[model samples]
Target chain A: MKRRAFMLSVGGAAAGMVLLPRMAFAEAGKIDWYTSSDQNILDFWTNVVKPKFEAANPGVTLNLVDAGDAAGQTAIGERALAAMQTKTDPQADYFESADWRLPAGAADAGLYVNIKEAGLSNYSRINPLAFDGDYSVPYRGSQVLLAYDTTKLDPANAPKTFADLVTWIKANPGQFIYNRPDKGGSGGNFVRRAILEANGKDLGKFKIDNYTQEAGDAALNPAWEILKDLSGSLFDNGAYTSGNTQSIQLLGQSAITMIPAWSDQAIQAINTGVLPETTGLVQLQDLALPGGFSRSVILSNGVNKDAALKLADFILTEEVQSAVLSELGGFPGVAWDYVSQDLREKYADVIPTTIPTFPGGDWEKAINDGWYRNVAPNVDRAA
Target chain B: MSLTPASDIVGKKPGRGLTGLLLVAIPVLLVCWMVIWPIISAIGRTLWLPNDGGTGRSFSVETYKFFFSDQYSLNNLYVTLWTTGVCAVLLVLICLPIALYLRFAKGRLAAYVQGLAIFPMFVPSIILSYAIIRVLGPNGTVDLLLNSVGLPHIRSPYLTPWGPVIGLVWDNIPLTVLILISGLGAVSNQSIEAARDVGAGRFAVLWHIILPRISNSILVAVSFTVLGIFSSFTLPYVLGPAAPEMMGPFMQRTFRDLNDPTNAITQAVIAFAFCIVFGLFYVRSVAKNRAR
Candidate 1:
């Protein structure tokens, strides 16, 4: 009798030990988030978003990881790809992606969980154009604009067209700077606009389904010629800044009068006193600047799929959208009617009636390659 | 000989063999897991093409072929080699004299110079790169100083290869100095003094006695500098020109910016090949020293 009792107690204890963790796991789940976003974004998500999320969904913790060191976005994409290839769950349940990285990263790799299929309610609020085919929910928008110091250059006299900008660059030598095309998207946008002006072709022709070498060569030749001609008039003759931030810093310090900048970044810099308050941004009337939307992605292979979808949906909420605009100086990802009138009016000038998207992946690669081969050498020689 | 029991010798062999196996097993396993496995994986990745969007994967040497054939890629390799060679030579020239002075000279001057030499190691490379840009960029501190002095502001080479070379040398000098100083410690002061007393000139003592003694350290420092500079990304990325970029940043650009992992892996493999060639010298030095 004693032996049977002891055996029974031991069996019960073992069963309890096994079952307790299962219950706890079901009760308290975890959501891991990976992002390459800057410090402000990280802080806002941690301090503001995390607590609210945790409060809304009881017994869930959010873990934010900085996956953007020396490796940058490639490392994050590679890890996601490896996880999919191995048929295993990815390390992070959700990923924060920039506009430029989303298409090549999560969309290309097919790593994102389809929020629409998952029945996320707030997913419908996002603009259909911002959707990368059910892979992402657009969170914020940024527009590439030409920034100038009001003290140095008159806003009324700012160039209204690409041709006028080129003429202005030549007339006011050593006052304008743009980053290397391959280095920053703002500079690349400027180059793409120049191509549009030079080619004088329908913009729709550039957006091809597949990349053809011959088409790319024919399209970029005129652009190379224009850049080569303008090389002599660039800051310090042809010494272009390496990145967007450097160009902004030069403008802030009154070293250069004008440069291409992201609208949100310029506003943030002005707010932070990194740039003078007199710094102003403008979009040329003839040349439509490239603008894109950043998205929140849920990994297809995430361990906590339900929670991940919830988090992604939560990011698209009006409260979070307003916070994105107020805190990050970013435009709302939702339509204008969804946001307040004040927020719309504040960013009215920078916001366009229609956002110009990138011409497709092939054109992007072609521009970078052509610049390296044809335009860069001339720029270097001119310098 | 006396009839020593064969069983007695055989009896101790098992314990001794077990101990030897444990000692060998630990480091062998470590090296296999840490070094060999990752290298094999990276090489495997290069062979298997990444699934680029809708494109399916297949084993091919096309990536390697592109790397070898492309002029831009070739220029990247050349730039890396050029930077490594110049940094190695310049580091040796600068650090050798400082090491000699610190080893032989007495007083606060030597101490002060030694302190200054190692000071850069404390400042982070990212911070140092920014500082270099601030001090040397157009209309920067150098230009400001020139203007203050009522002189014309001169253009700085901060946007060219020379800029990165200067930053790399400044960043690497501390490590080279420390190694060379340690090497100098092996050369006894008495031998140098005795050679001097024997009517050998300063250059002769250096060439004959000190050079031979510290040759291994110099080799180590040069190999390390070459390896570090070849794989370096920060200084080159921040300070070097956009075109004719170093292999590190070029590979990064190819991988991240261009979204071409296959080509990036190929570049990495080429860099790894260079490292292996230089690493052999370090292994040889260690083995030769052990033999001696």
Candidate 2:
């Protein structure tokens, strides 16, 4: 009798587990998305973006993998490349990066069906800078800025140019920070801007820019001299090379007064209570930072390219745009004029007019050579 | 130097039994395939990169010129060699006394101390670097406490190259001590008593008896430690800013950073060749000692 009772109880428990939840979710189709967005934002993409898409396309399931943090933007692209090379099936259906890695073989993936052919009328909504061949599309963007603690300095006395930022760093020893370009932070862009500023070139003329012998020597010589003169005042004699996390921590502790911070880092610091409310971000007036792009590319190794386009179209929707901006802190890379006033106002602070880009085809090579591995300890050592 | 007890049973056949052979082959091949292969491929791609994407990517000097002509790369190499050489020697010297003490000391207390000595090995290098910084940085625990105690604050350890060297040596000590203890164990108590009876003082006994008996193990441990420190990447990357860049970072730049696998491979092969030449001598020394 006791054995029968236990068996009956076991059967009852199994039945309850099945019947207690939304059993309709099992009928969904799976669309795999591989992305490098942050955890919380990705959770929003999975929970908010997936369900909304699945609700529209009932049989499709969405499986979103956090591939970005697992390795990096490069490694994720390499994994896809390997999959493509080996002709592996069921490779990630969609791929994305803050910067479109593997930009060389993007079109060779033989995956993405054109947004026009895929019936994506919303392509008109995206910016021309982002709209291209079916291989990839810009995800979203945030303007890189020089973030600082206003409490440490009056706004009236705030830095207006890269030169000013450098001066401020020198005046306050051991309190400035930023990551290197090779280290995956936008340090390269800042370094380039410094070179551009030293050359006295107009910001608009900065494109596919080559670091000439003159540029490498003349522009960087002053920068290096200044850095060398100011080196003793840097954080631990200019030894503390750190990413946003460490820099932010130091900023919170009043250890660093300045950094070349991206919008997301500043936003995250504010939200997480790392940055005080008095903290401020300012775009450099003289030198534009043409760095930082979030490219959400269409990748279909085996899944439905047509279906993937449907998802892409859905993601670029005004409603989805609003959701992504509010939830993920993503600024639009489209003809963002049509966005709601609320969206415009929220992202207004972060967006720069012309974010510096790799001006030349060999942009990475230029920066790696130009920036001294994106970390010219002395501005003079740029070559 | 493992003995073949049943070699007489097989006249001309010179080999281990199946179990012994499998044990050796499995581990040896596994290492060669996994670790050695990737390392070789990385170096190969760097050194022998084709002028054009086709058949044989023959040898070239462009990669080397690109690597060494730049002051950055040269300085990085300088940093790596200086730090590794200094730290390895320091690691051996510091651990020798600790190893001797652990071997000679009595009771469970010594075991506990020895355990504590090795505990840092379990901590990740990243975490260990942060802890060192927190204690030794300008605003770290030491400075904060010193200030509170009414003493003038001292400079941050981060400002000096010693910050990284000390950290590296600290990380190496436990393994060094372990090697030394195992080596010292091979010195039978009989040998010590024999030396003492001969009117040999403590220093004489250690120099003649202990040193000679355990020299093989010491050599083995030193070989591994020096190479390990040479290959170490992350600790120094974080710890020292002013220090010259090391070989690991240099290789990373040449291949990974430059996307030039050919030159990177050549440099790696050079490093591997350096290791092998020394490794042979080290192994030969051990074999010679064990045979005695």
Candidate 3:
């Protein structure tokens, strides 16, 4: 090989390596929407959302990537953070079910676009309760509620307050259970409800930003006592389910009559006939069980930032929000008025008037750890 | 057989030493890069503790201290060890009879038994967990059958400590049986015939001849089973109790759910320290076999 030819070949290969990825992203108009949602959400995105979005906006592609779970999404967030700090292509355009505070300061660092001020056309439809922050867009909502087998208990007779739920569990031992608080938000919010009951339902005590270990322990100690007192009423005498799905499965099998479950998962299970047709959902009337909204963030250094923002705005539109209710069995991120009237009437039975949420951060971490340590210390070995 | 070292063999050939070293270096470097490096990095992270208020950093054992001092952490460790020991015993009790039958019994039944013994190896752990749940969980197949027969509700082992034990023993049966059967191959038919000729009964022959020769295989099987069960996450996470969880689920909860990575690493370090004992036994067995 001649020296000139060898150098030319090497240079061409290097340039191709660098420019090929950019060309693919630009020409393909690919927007990678990484989500940590479950199989049903992924199915809804692939089957319904992807096709409609691509048809409406030709030359743009929405690649839905399953970001396994919370931990997996956190790893992706960390990688994006590193790419942003280094001024490199993040390879990630959108993050679904993630928060602006993931890499611990990416939002404040101006690494994420402020979706509210981004002049999205459908910003008027955003629910005030679901409007979490400036740097992220809330796309869908879900909350924890009591799921009961209607064959075992009448829907009208279901427990309406936290106190009534506890009384019902004690009245019918081994007919109720929740998952471990560390495993899913269903059980986590159940524990949170207990904390509220213990503290006179004061939502003001727990704050996301100002968390002190001393105050948290003081608030949580009473809640632990209440939970421990009601432990024997749980399935298998305090053997908690591992996660949300297991609790739902046990209910489906008629092993347990009632459980705290995520509204989206419960409705999906009922709609898909995984849960029995007799299954019913209800919210506590005295103090609403805590709910959460799944947010999507657009990274500033993402390879296709404009396409990602467009997708984000598209998710908040009334059509997609209505699909979130009917197809995915999740609550709409938009206001109830913005959702389709018939679909809203169909789900009126489970629609919550208020979506109270417990603060995360040190408070959540402390509650989960303290639950394992104090409330559920006794191992329920099978007899 | 001449017991000349490989070094001597390479020394006698020209340029073979370099080729042999390169061939060995590839796997050696790969193991160092993949396995040993991550382990060392994890251990360093556990020791790299931040001071109070996140002002300064220093190498400390505070996380280990927390693990040892906390009763909940201690309970998790105890449950993990208990589950591993019980599964090892169950695997042996279940697999040994099948292995012995496969070794001596020659018939279609033996072939079917071998096939059944190795079936779980091809099944993934997630699928295995689901199968176990369907078969043994509440209102599952067992309950349905028992209820149909007018039997009272059976207390299920699922979601209890015994849950992981049952799942792990079933998941591990194939590997243990294969190892034991391979070990039983060392016992020749001629030797059994010779023992029988001397008026030794089957029990006597098995006790004197078969069990003694298969001791190394048994050790290797137990070592591998212990290591696998001790580090297992899926079965335990799905089947085991929420409190007093095995180290796998416990570490996961500490890291992901509880958002305490430093303590999670400490838990991993401690779990690794426990598995190292079995790992050493495995290494020594391999070394002894090589020495022979």
Candidate 4:
């Protein structure tokens, strides 16, 4: 009798172990948030956002998984797409910094939730320009700005236009630098700004969906010529920094006087003492530099869809959006009217009126590859 | 008469052969599953590229044609080969002397020398790259020293082809020393003493006696160093120049940044083809040693 009772208890316990997460989800559901964001942003989410969000809604847990790199994030997207097709649990609640139109047919198949219509109370506060397609939520934005050391060059004499910037580069050789286009956004947009100038500031010529091989080649030729002309005036005679941080480091090391740097990164560097306090940031006046937004999309097939939607809505509230600026060194997804007056007043000199968007699909690939071939050819050297 | 028969002692027993097979089976299966299958799959993907209309997939060599015909890709391949060759030669040159000292010298200082030689193994490659930049880049420690003495600044290797070469050589020294020291172990001291008694100089003893015995080990070290340096990514990415990158970074940029996986896989397959040559040298040396 004792043996039979023991067998029955074992069976009951095994069933409970299998079904508990599903049955008790309303009481305690863990939202698996997948992201490829930088370490500081992850820290902001973990240390600042997670605690507050979890406390307000006691049962829901925000689990941040640092998906290592771009490839890891892409794999998560593919897995979500696969689960949607098979009508199974995606095991993922949210994906950060994802290209929403990926996995080829994901958009058509409705793999991602329509985030704008997911019952977000703060939906009206989002900047209309940042609200792209409404399939993903744009939480923050970053633009490339001209970062210069004040001691080396006075702020009043800084270049106000792309034309002025070019002349300045020519006048002060080895005093300016930017990273490689393929490596970081600051350099990529510096190249893009040049392209824009080459095309007579015609933004309409470049579109999100419009890039053919022949068209891309013809459009980029003038930009290459412009870059090649300025190559001899650059730091170390056309040597580019490897990435965003390297450009900032060069300024810190007093190796260069000015560089094209991401606004968020430059600000963070100054705040963290990586770059000196004298480093100043300014945007171009004639034409605004292109910027990118970090967007998060919800998986339709997620097991914790309702709770994930709640968290997604919570992310857009003024509280979290304000912290994104003060703590994380990022631009708010909401317009300046919704942000705190102090932040607006403080960053008035550097904040852009409008963040121009650049097509990341095919245009970026063509430009990066062309830069290596036409602009910066290898120079022979002995180690 | 009391002992077991000669056949029982000399021949393999049925259970013993089964145990040997069992012992080797797990690792062999793991290698086939983990390493071999992925390589085959990657090679297969490189061949079946997307069609021109972007509608269907078919077998094609267009990616290979692009890689071979493109000057940029060819230059990257050339840089990778040159970097590997230089790092291998430097590693052998630097590590052989240290190995000989550790092998022949006696005292606590020799132990300390061995410790210092193996120190790089513990430092991560990323940290080593940053340290290299701090010590050797513009306005760095070396430049500051030069300035203090009223000398010219260094032509920094931070963003040149030599940048990755320096980092890789430093990163590879520890393993190279260990291999060389182990190889030097087979050289008995009595032979060296005999050569000394016959009036042979240090160079002659090394060339005629020590080098011949350690030639296989040197080959092993060079082969390992060549393979490691050829596919190295972090050092090359962080330190090397933007244009004409090594094959590792080239493949990565083509795959991730350029969004051209087919071309990236083709680049990888080409690198694999080059690495196989050195791999064969390692295999041959191992086979020769086992025979001896």
Candidate 5:
């Protein structure tokens, strides 16, 4: 009887989530928006999306709130969910979240107004593989590119291929720093893919249930052994991948020679004086991994759907795409084909969007392929 | 408060009716809402899950089945248990000697040494761990020095399953020292003088007299260190190898990033249950000791 009462209480609490006020008390005209982008990007979003978007559609407000990176997004999302659970509406209207966060967050919070129901009729051109494409859309892509400090090496000594990078790591001891796969998202994921590729393993034939411990171990054995050797030789003494801002600073400060970084992130570092502008980037010879794209998820707080659509469409248009490309170092989508011609000639040397390739593996097939935890030290060093 | 509590009705004074009620009610209710509610919520979320394990659907024992059914997990459990157990025993063995020395020694040097012994506690564990790695790891300063001297470079075995034991012991020593120091002070001076007058040797005095007097402090320190190591994740995760291996690393992997909250919950449940079982055993022994 006691257990039943307790469980019933729990049910009542959960059902309470449904009773939250969906109404906004903000001034009658404007729609509020929130995003977890960088401050610089937030500046861009508000500068471009708010005033221009608001003027174009009168009485509409675009409130672009910057909520930092993935970690920051998770914290803010939790707070919002807690506030709403107590019969409150979130302060911000629209939120942008990464692909990994939406499933655990948006699905549970019940915050979203289904884009399909809200008259968002088409997004077929965007890769539907985005987190099973159940919620959210592709907003911005953070491509994994190989970037090196010019002060550390001449062009002749610069890394070109996967093999060249490995050789470089080995030759220069205690200098290489890749984020641990389980801790850092961008660098860690890319490194895991690279390890899989380096070993020439098949990504598709992996089964989870009958996953042989030995087989999985053997598959990653070479990579582990290689990493073990490189631990003292090239890896950071601290044993953690640099924090995102710290990584950007490391590149700017020329503390490292070669690092795996998002193309835009690398460019932003250079533009912000965190990294030298002379630092260059290159993609690996064979790998063309999936891009990490951020999405703008519009909430249906009784806002104008047509206006929201117009804003999204305008951002995806050629002129806006060109502006984003020129300012943000963003690679052009099909809409900005005109500007892409000149971009291809000038910046084409660095940014390439030719194909979608991975390190020949799926994360589902290999748990080791996921982001690394910042906790794991170079334990084997002591061993 | 309601009606002067009947007994106090005819007595000298009564409690403040509304103020007292409001104070107790507000804090008790707030505590339940804040801390207790979220823990209950996390545990509750762990228990209930959808059948199909679809997008949001959960698989419950599927997580448990993965953990308990795996041979690797079994090995890790054994390793963790063995490490924690051995560490408790070893911590007593190591700290007892230093504790005994500190108990007897006196003067300015002792005062400085007492403070210095606790210096490790003041410095952050993360910083200390890094220092240990630098001094003890394969290519660290000590090893490098050994190599330069044409000696074989040596790395401590503390990095493996046994490494956490070293860290736990190191962390617990200062605490143990303080506890022991107090217990030793409480030992009757006359009792020690009488034993010595009767021709008790130093070793005999230590074994028969000092140890018994300080047993409570020793038990307290041991229990604390054991519980700490058993529940710890950060040090092992930071200093141990990848999965199919260590408990700390495995718990993090299964639960944290995998979005398999069910598995994380299972691991948590198992840990909670394990801690409770051991805690009860420890308390029972303590009660028995007290009764004696």
Candidate 6:
């Protein structure tokens, strides 16, 4: 009888060892955050946010999975969609996606949780337009700015409008460059902005979905003409750089004096000594450049729904927004007035007043296809 | 010993048949699971549009039509074919001599050259691309060297098809050289000596005897190089011109950047079809060589 009692005691102890941890974990849920943010932003989150969030909510652990950079994010999104289709739990509770991909890529596919229904407090602080059917919150904003080497070109003489830019390119041939539209969104944005410039006040019509072939041809004709005309004046007589980073590299090497670049990327490049400090950025006054916000999307079927909501709230707080600006060189997710006065003044030129979101996927594909077919062939004709 | 009956021998045939089935079953199952299933799924994807919420499930040739009808799409095939042709020729011309030396010559220099030839195999394709860019880009190492000697700065062709061709050749040389060296090892040196004794010069021996023996290896090298160049993404994406891009990068761009999986699958199917043609040639060459 004593030996039987001892065996029961050992069995009870083994069960207790396993049960205790489970009971402890039951109190504090874990959040898995997958992001495509760069290394610096990831570092900021891990070093700064993770510890504080965990400290405040005891026993809670924040797991940050690096989904990859821009292209990698799309791949993750595709995987997440596949998981959702199979009724399996997605690998991530929250994911960060590029702004341009929203409404067509992730948001349209119903991959994100509705923030309003989730009762996130900071939802109101975000620009309502940034809300993609209340499924995502804008985490950071970037504008396509015309960056130039001040050493090569006088800043005062910089182009103020599309027309002025064309005239300047003609006079200083081979001094300006833009990447291929299909390769990088920055170049794509430049083409879209040029289309806007070409169409004048017909931007709304072009923004519409399901354009007939005749309608698309007529609307995009002037833009093609402008691109073909400007091709002769581009760097290397219309041989465009293949990617956005290449354009910045050429500017740094003084191979070209002017190129279209992302505001945050250009500034970050300067800070990292990739571009010399003499490099300056300017937004065209007459033409509103394409600007959009990268967003934090909470998956609907995420494991830790409450913890994910808490984490989203923590990310949108003023402290994190300030860090995003100071550390990442990104425009704040909140309004400019909400950030420090110094930051507002420092980035006044780049702080986008007229941010234009990308049209849906179909329109984007049409635009890319049209540029390749119509404009690309005529690029070197004049040269 | 007593003689075995015919019925007894027939009874043992079932046991041998069972053993044979056991041996081949695992391999057959593995091939079906790993290769055939995926190929079937890929082919299915080409036929059907994905039911991405809006689009209802239906069989369609729209994807294939879209890909073939577009000139931009067709240019990708042209670029891939051109690059593959150039790289195949270049790899053969460059690797054959080094391979011959490694097989025929016996010295420290041959060993050193062999080491140098295979050294690039260790370097990743992406790193090799960047290295080529650094060496051949505008105002790069080559330009710098030329400038030091007071020569005019020549524009870099590194941003064109030539650049990718150079990188592809450099990357593929090791495999080609290894194959050729193995083929040369099988070429009997005694036969070459006998031919020489009969008034066959070095050129005649190489052309008449060595070439015929190693033709299989040459075919293997050429086929592999063509396949590698056709499907190569990193070298062409990093080095080649934006327009007239290779099929690999073009498919990726169409799929991810354009977010059109159907069109991308169609392109993949076309690429697979090309690979199958080359693969058949490889199989036939090996079969013929083995028969001989």
Query: What's the DockQ of model 6?
Result: 0.14
lDDT of candidate model 1 versus the reference: 0.78
TM-score of chain A of each: 0.84, 0.76, 0.90, 0.88, 0.71, 0.81
**CAPRI verdict (incorrect, acceptable, medium, high) for model 2:** incorrect
Model 3: per-residue lDDT, tens digit, A162-268? 88999999999999989888777888899999998999999988888877878887899999999998987788988888888888888988999999988888888
Residue lDDT tens for model 5, A87-133 = 55555455654442343565556655454444443344444433224
Cα error of candidate 4 at position B4, Å: 14
Model no. 3, DockQ:
0.31
By TM-score, who's the top model here? Answer: 3
Pick the winner on TM-score between candidates 4 and 5: 4
Candidate 3: residue A246 lDDT (0-100): 82
In angstroms, how far off is B106's CA in candidate 5? 2.8
Of candidate 1 chain B, the 10-residue stretch with the lowest lDDT total is B1-10
Candidate models: Cα lDDT each: 0.78, 0.65, 0.85, 0.84, 0.59, 0.77
Candidate 6 deviant stretches above 4 angstroms: A1-30, A36-87, A98-111, A127-130, A201-203, A206-212, A379-383, B1-31, B38-69, B197-200
Residues B147-266, candidate 2: write the lDDT tens digits: 898998686655355667878888888888888899898888898899899899999988998998887877887787778777776666666663355676556665665676666666
The DockQ ranking, best first, is: 3, 4, 1, 6, 2, 5
Determine the iRMS, in angstroms, of model 2: 17.5
- TM-score of chain A, model number 2: 0.76
What tens-digit string does per-residue lDDT give for candidate 3 at B1-292? 2233553454354234444454455557668988899889989888887788888778898888988999889989999999999999999999989999999998899899999999989999988887888889999999999999999988889888988899899899999999999999999999989999999998999899999999999999999999999999999999988788899988888888777888888998898899899999999998999999
Predictions' DockQ, in order: 0.19, 0.10, 0.31, 0.28, 0.08, 0.14
Q: Over the stretch B1-292, how does candidate 6's per-residue lDDT look in tens digits?
A: 1133452344444434444554555557667988789778888988877666876677888778877888788887888988898889889999998998899898899889999999989999989977776678766788889999999977676556787888999999999999899889889989999999999998999999999999999998888778777899998888877677789988888877677777787898999899888888889988998898
Sorted by TM-score (best first), the order is 3, 4, 6, 1, 2, 5
iRMS (Å) per candidate: 15.7, 17.5, 12.2, 13.6, 12.4, 17.1
The residue ranges of model 5 lying beyond 4 angstroms of the native Cα positions read A1-87, A91-97, A104-142, A146-159, A163-179, A195-282, A288-383, B1-65, B120-167, B244-249, B285-292
- lDDT string for model 5 (B27-101, tens) is 566679975786677666666566664556453556567778866667677777877788788878877887777
What does candidate 1's lDDT look like per residue over B27-87, in tens digits? Answer: 5766898888988887998888757685877787878888889887888899899999999
User: Which model, 1 or 5, shows the larger TM-score?
Assistant: 1
Stretches off by above 4 angstroms in model 1 are: A1-29, A37-40, A51-59, A69-87, A98-111, A117-124, A127-129, A380-383, B1-69, B106-112, B199-204
Q: Write the per-residue lDDT of candidate 2 for residues A1-383, one digit (tens) a residue.
A: 13333355556555645654462221124666777655555766777888898898878877777774423445655665666678765455666553333545645565443445555667777777765444456656665677788988777787887778778887876677665555545455565666566556455444444646554455456544544555566666555453445556556656567777666667767876878887887887765665655666666554555566777777778877776566656576566764788778867766567676545334455555545543444533212
